[model samples]
Target: MLSTTNPFTLKNIADYQYFSKEKIETAIQKSSDAFEKWSEISVSERLNFIKSLINTLTKNKQLLAETAVAEMGKPLKQALAELHKCKLLCEFYLQNSDFFLTGRKINTDGCESYTKYEPLGVVLGIMPWNFPYWQVFRFVIPTIIAGNTVLLKHSSNVAGCSILLEKLFTEAGFPENVYQNLLIPGSDVKKVIENKTVKAISLTGSEKAGASAASAAANQIKKAVLELGGSNALIVLNDADLEKTIPEAVIARFQNTGQSCIAAKRFLVQRGVYDTFMEGFTAQVAALKSGDPMNENTYIGPMARVDLAEEVEKQVNDSVAMGAKIVLGGKRNNAFYEPTILTNVTPDMPVFSQEVFGPAVPVIPFDTFEEAVALSNQSDFGLGVSIFTSDIEAIKEKVHRFQEGAVFINALVKSDPALPFGGIKRSGYGRELSMEGIHEFVNVKTVYIK
Candidate 1:
């Protein structure tokens, strides 16, 4: 049995029995069957169903947000914001999916030729607990609209949210089998990926999980899209406006309690402004309210689970042991971990070398803008980087030198419905969101008329 315990109170929220082998088989078959009809429908017709989904989500947004807060430890307000973002994603695709999926006509020696975007069959999604609703919706909305059915195996900790998501789709008038949530453990995922009916897989999780799932898909010669871990750098130049940069830096590191994959983990400030940046940044972080996630005033909450908190505490403690100085908070109580800031952090420290999936910021001083870029690129994860500088035009010229998937100027790294979001290297591959996302599961076929 998979049980969901509220991270805040440590009480059992719900329990779910894992899907048996027969149930899993039935789900795969149903999704495969549904794809036949779902793919046959025109893009305009499919969009009508999506419009209904947006309405259903709006009606139940509160319930969805509350469930996420109970399951994970994100603040209630942030959970609601995640649902709103999901809605925006749905709206964005509603306006643009038809144009994106439409075939392109091309001149050819034959009578006529063009490229047709056709839907693949059933696609499997292996999603994580963080940003549960937004992660699933971003992948499924586009996949279903493009005419591919989805099979979701959500994290066990968010089982309630997962089941609720499937229900919302049905309430939105989606057909019986277009979207199915499989209550199976990670061990069972390989067999499902190997199933003949499952055409592709999309995963948003750790590097280990990505490697395992991606290998299974590769063995089946199926496509895989992964949005994995990140240790993004937040670089502050000497010329940066502290008034603007400090607040953005605080949000970059501490938002969502720092569980976000794109959340800035390292603060690489130029030596001239390093002291000022740390002083203001720590003040902002210290002022953030930490309490029960349900509270309206709460900005920081527990780190999803006690083990997760323990892991983060160890990362902070280890860094301290390695000559890193803890400037602000670094205490753990049950599932709650204090928002921590570290300075004198060297490249070899755990906080600098690894992805800390908690609210712990490591400040590393650099002498030059070139050194800042070099420091930012010194990670195994190449997800993104946020550079704060007054000279936006001068920084624009150096953006290409950063070895990251995205570079944000005087802003935090974030995912938007209008832009492609994904990372490189160990952060995983392929893009999600925007035009690149909807195309990931579809077949780009060549049509020829002679």
Candidate 2:
């Protein structure tokens, strides 16, 4: 049985029964059947359906936001922000999907030649719990609007959010089986991936899960898009405006209580300004409010579950044992982990090398701009990096030196509906937003005529 416990109260919220193998077979068939008729519709018709879905999201925003908070422990305000972002995703596709899927004319010797985008039949999305609504919408919105049906196998902890999402689709007038939630555990994910009717897979989770899913898809000769873990760096150059850089650095590290794959895990500051940055950064982190997730004013909440909090604690303790110093918070109470900062950290420590998924970060000092870039690229993850400096033009020339998927100057790295978001190396592969994202599950067909 799949179940959820409130991260704040540590009390059971609900339980869900896993789908049997036979039921999985039925769901896939239903999705395949739905894809045929759904894919045959006009792009204009699809946009109208998406408009209805957006309206449904608007009507049920509070319910959806609260469900995420009850299941995951994100602050209520942030949860609402997640729903809002989901709405923006739907609206983005609604406005541009027709153009995105439209065939393009190519200059060729033939009388008429061009390329067309067609959806793969049934695409399965394996999503995570953090930013539950936004993650699911980012993957599903574009895929379905491109004329594909979806089956979601969400994180076990956020089962409520998953089931509710399926219902929202139906309420929005989506046809039967257009979007179904598969209530199954991680073990059964391979079974779904191996199903012949399941054409493609899009997953957002840990490295191990992405590897396993990619392997299964490989064996089946099916395509998969994986968005995995990241230990991103927030590099503060010696010439950076500390006023602007310090506040963004705090939000980059501690937002969503630091449970994001794209959250800034390492702070690489130039030696000249390292001490000054720490003073302001530490003070801001200390001033953050912690309380019940449902509380509007709570800036910090529990880590989703007790085990997750324990994992962060282990990373912190191990780093301290390896000579890292805890300059600020380093305490855990059940599922609640205090916002933590570690200094005197080397690249060898767990906090620096591994993806820390809770409210903790490590600060490392660098001697030169080249060293800061090297320190940022030292990890197995290449999801993204952010550099803060006043010399935008000089930094622009050096942006190519960092081996990351995305980079932000004078700001934190973020995912936008209009921009492509994904990573290389251990962070997994394939894009997830914008034109590239909508095309990930589509067949780019070339046609020529005499």
Candidate 1 residues 263-309, lDDT tens each?
99988989999888888888899999999999989999988899999
Kindly report which residue stretches of model 2 are placed more than 4 angstroms away from their true locations once superposed: none
Please list all clashing residue pairs in model 2, or write none if there are none: none
TM-score of each: 0.99, 0.99
TM-score of 2: 0.99
Model 1: pairs clashing at backbone N, Cα or C within 3 Å: none
Give per-residue CA lDDT, model 2, range 196-315, as digits (tens): 999999999998999999999999999999999799999998999999899999999999999999999999999999999999999999999999999999989899889999999999
In lDDT terms, how accurate is model 1? 0.94
The residue ranges of model 1 lying beyond 4 angstroms of the native Cα positions read: none
